[model samples]
Target: MKTDLNQLEPQALVDAFLKYPPAGFQVHEPDNFLAFFYTRFNLLTTLDVALHQKIKALPGYRHWQNMLHLQTCFVGTTVTEYTLLSAQLSAQQMTEFLKQHIQKTRLTIIKDLPLNSPFISEMENNYSQELIKSAEKNGFLSVEGQALAYVPIDFENREDYLSRLSKSRRKNLKRKLKSLNEIDVEILATGHAKFQDAEFTAQLYRLYLNVYHQSEIHFDLLSPAFFQAILQDGDSGGTVLFYWVGTALAGFNLCYEYRGNLVDKYIGFNYPLATDHNLYFISWFVNLEYARVRGMKFYIAGWTDPEVKAQLGAEFTFTRHLVWIRSPVLRFILTRLRSVFEADHHWHQQQELKS
Candidate 1:
């Protein structure tokens, strides 16, 4: 659809972006930053949708009124939202506008938001209490640039680490690896595979689907397009990793390594031994080994099943997320609304779990 900026409708704009975001947003050479970003982190898509919708519903966002939103279904960890605000605004005004949205107001709309923005200065000022409060409410990991290069690992000492061991845990993992290894388990990087080879890819696809059929939890299974995105990306120095045992694919992990962290972004696996296969257990060893070989510092495993992960020698870490708004009034409303949103989501999740 040809969008005339003058005719852009806020709600319609949201719907249009949602309905049809820009194809140019993909992770091609020129747009690689956005593409590689969206590839690894689909969560940015969630954040982007929320931002677009909320902005559209706002009382007066005249600047966006004359812009066409673009959604580029790209390959990589980040996805973003952008449009030409106006040629009318001076360069200084435009810079401030982008900086405001980039650092403030649940800036999840833009994946890989530029660090040179004014938010860098605020983060330097020991972080405003409001930013702390907003991040806590939303459960986001704050990126404080050089002030905090990393979130501290959570484990205190070896007692919790020691607890990770059981009477037969090592016996268990070694046996699983040995058995699978003997069975001719094929461990290969998914990034290197010819994903266009549907026959080869489907073998792994079926292995994953088997889990969905056997399990009760809701999982995010990829489509052919998603896998293809990763493959195309690897064609140009980007990648996703996988480990398959024989004809049955066993495990997969996706990541983008930079600044010395593997960032265990996502994974999937299937083993005849089920959970006993220690596939999940072996993941830590896999990460640690890779970290060693790659000369990386930390695993950056993300926040999930922390207690269990901590037991596996991962130290507890703390990072902060911030939300800044251009208007104080809007900031207040957002802060309050965040509380309500969390309470409701928790209730809904609990109900879902019970059901």
Candidate 2:
């Protein structure tokens, strides 16, 4: 069930990152076998908002924050659906790679490495866990991050799916679905002629930025080129749905169909209009309906807004990050304060109780 990155031609890896590197990162071509990008990293990105504000209220918080700013190299692309690593790379080899790379940069992070993936082999999952253990053994900071939410499409219809949720939740979702009557829904695929238009592509890019800038946690500003690439790649199995209210674009979701799953990826919204129309809840069900009609076995709802996703009947699987701080003192400090980064895990637990 594991996907092999080695199955991709080496040139494809080079082209993929070079064309659509994470925004503001300087892409490095160290070798054809690996993807690397460097950027300034803020240590507080993963902390819970309330905890972050509390930390900010502490004396000399600005000085502490300034000290935490790091010039870091990330071993994998954050924008990708999953972390891409060469199959041949071992835990020791990755540790050595990070050890060497961190010498140039203040920190080296292997972000979003899957602790356990349904699409990964037992060997690969073990490799990821071992890599985290090895990193921790080498005095690196290993942080278990968040869950990538998903819904297994096991029902006969939308009503059957809703019946599985709590009575109140099902009623609330049904109320939100009323907005669908006012919105015009259009679904487009990657090869659509509209994606070829320069102005239309730019418009979609701006919408993506609208959502990105409004997000609570800001990381990995995807480039316009990335959107254009996915829009135009007919073979990528990409599907985009646009929600329209009269002549205006209310929102859009860019997703993909792959291996019996509808992978919900990027989304963009035209703010007040989207909120006024309850577009979030509307789109959530729309996606579920899409996958259900297609007979897909799962809807991979992506890695944001876990609380909201949980309310919408999504189940989750989590991932971990291995962060190697170059300074021994900083590593020691982070080791003591690692619980600050476990906010998402805590939220996941709360969701379990509500369920």
Candidate 3:
């Protein structure tokens, strides 16, 4: 079980990785935030569990300083080169520790789609060929993208949520819903929705595209396959699908129950229906109101929707990242050195943009 990993090439490393499955490892100033999380091996679960404990116990909750999507999956923390803190274990012991206690043993490596890489046609596919050929390997890969955080109508304190809203926007939404009510309109929350294939996902993807494009703000374009993976995952865990105005495909917002909070991750509205029937704001009723009724601590609307969320009396908080430890101090040093050595090439592009 005690293997010296340094002796292997990427191919061999892939073999040992699937065999032991990393609990934690070193990451340097990551590119694409995580496109290169581990050129070596995955981070382990001990550190991940510790990281989550530290994150939840941080002073943020009282201060309302919560993280959006990247809520410190210590098992998968990305780090700077050569950084060391206090993990207090040899690599061998740490490896044994992770294999023993990880709740979700079927761990996954996440890759943002359309990754800016030519060698890997689909980064997940590339990561897969290396991983699947070795282990349980049925390719149960689940991918979820971070949504722009929404400003929720209810915060830790109801007053904080209300005080943040503008009077005009609040009044307009209320009036809009009331007006709909008079016309015999009904809004319903569809239970635990799923999109089994690319077509359904494509429809949702198109709706997501329209909402993002309508804002004229830059956002990632998710493929239909991406949404299908999420829906498949949702069936195991409870998912929220809502229907509005009778025949609208409204949307399925994937929710996760973690650390006593529910995160509403992906969402797609029938944009045409949203426009034709004014169904967009109904999301406010279904997602938020449902969370409140369920006695959940927070209803996470993904990022960038803060502007619209503010209308619902949602408060905003900035997330912070802290580095505590890195192992094989020499590994940290060499990685940092590589990044610095590579920086000059990367810096020129920024310099040219300014010039």
Candidate 4:
């Protein structure tokens, strides 16, 4: 639940990652990051419901799904991440460490590296590439994962920004904003006295759960404790913008500033009212305005929903994971089945059409 990994002790983060191990998986701490070894069935990639169902109907599908993976405890949004001691590891050191750890743990598959710009630079893209290439030489397979969406905030005002959008989008957004003319919206930070209230924390957690449950692709279910930890952490730099309909809460956006970029992390809303008021579109503009007013260089909207994000004038940045399977038989099987784990080129094509 701890939001600021910088503030928490390294051991605490390790303990948190180990809190809930998936069935048939045991936690392994190789240096600073936690990896999980799956003793039974596991998914190597995300699949659409129809394909997943079809695969489930196939014989030996359970065995096909089984593999080891890197631990990803907090995946609400894909903010580039690294090992706890990543700051201290050089590219060569990291490569050697990973090689040694994989050998020691006897892990066949390593999924979701989730390297951000900083981690990528620290590890050096060339070194990371060589590591994957070396793994491939030894029969490992690497594949592209999800792409993250981000907006660079450069306009002087909301209208100035609106002018850059397509005429239809500009008109539609203005119409959406007009519907929320009377709603009360207040942005509060962790340093604010009102944010200390336990009731607000509880309400925020409830809203988060609502959004999580409604989501089509559910990966990580964040705990209330995580929200509370981030809210209470003096160094986390977390903030929230509350949308109110008179005395009742309609919606809220939880975000933070990381190195001059406004990271729009999570959102929760009271469904019917949120839909009625067009809170999603309203929040998008409001967050952009907030970032612009604060003079932030970029606004990271997070991963998924590429079509909508592209429509909003955000740019895409793709991420990838390097996977290595130990068994020759399984490795051969995966090589033949690699297309299943590759990035959704069809989805990318659909997004390109929208653009």
Global lDDT scores for all candidate models: 0.39, 0.79, 0.39, 0.62
lDDT of 2 at 110: 79
For all candidates, what are the clash counts? 32, 0, 17, 1
RMSD (CA, Å), each prediction: 13.0, 3.0, 17.8, 5.3
Instruction: Please give, for residues 35-121, the per-residue lDDT of candidate 3 as tens digits.
Output: 112332222211223453565586655465322222222323221101111223343343344334333322333222211212123
lDDT of 4 by residue, 88-175 (tens): 5444554455556554333344444443443234444444455556655554577666656778887888888888899999988888
Misplaced by over 4 Å in model 3 are 1-169, 179-194, 234-238, 250-252, 320-355
Winning candidate number (lDDT):
2
In angstroms, give how far residue 193 of model 2 lies from its true place.
0.7
- Whole-structure CA lDDT of model 3: 0.39
**Candidates sorted by lDDT, descending order?**
2, 4, 1, 3
Per-candidate TM equals: 0.45, 0.91, 0.44, 0.76
Question: Which of the two, 2 or 4, has more lDDT?
Answer: 2
Scored by lDDT, model 4 comes in at 0.62
Instruction: Encode model 1's per-residue lDDT on 220-299: one tens digit a residue.
Output: 34454444444434432233555544555566655445444555544566666435455666556555555556665555
* RMSD of candidate 2 to true structure, Å: 3.0
Model 4 TM-score, all chains together: 0.76
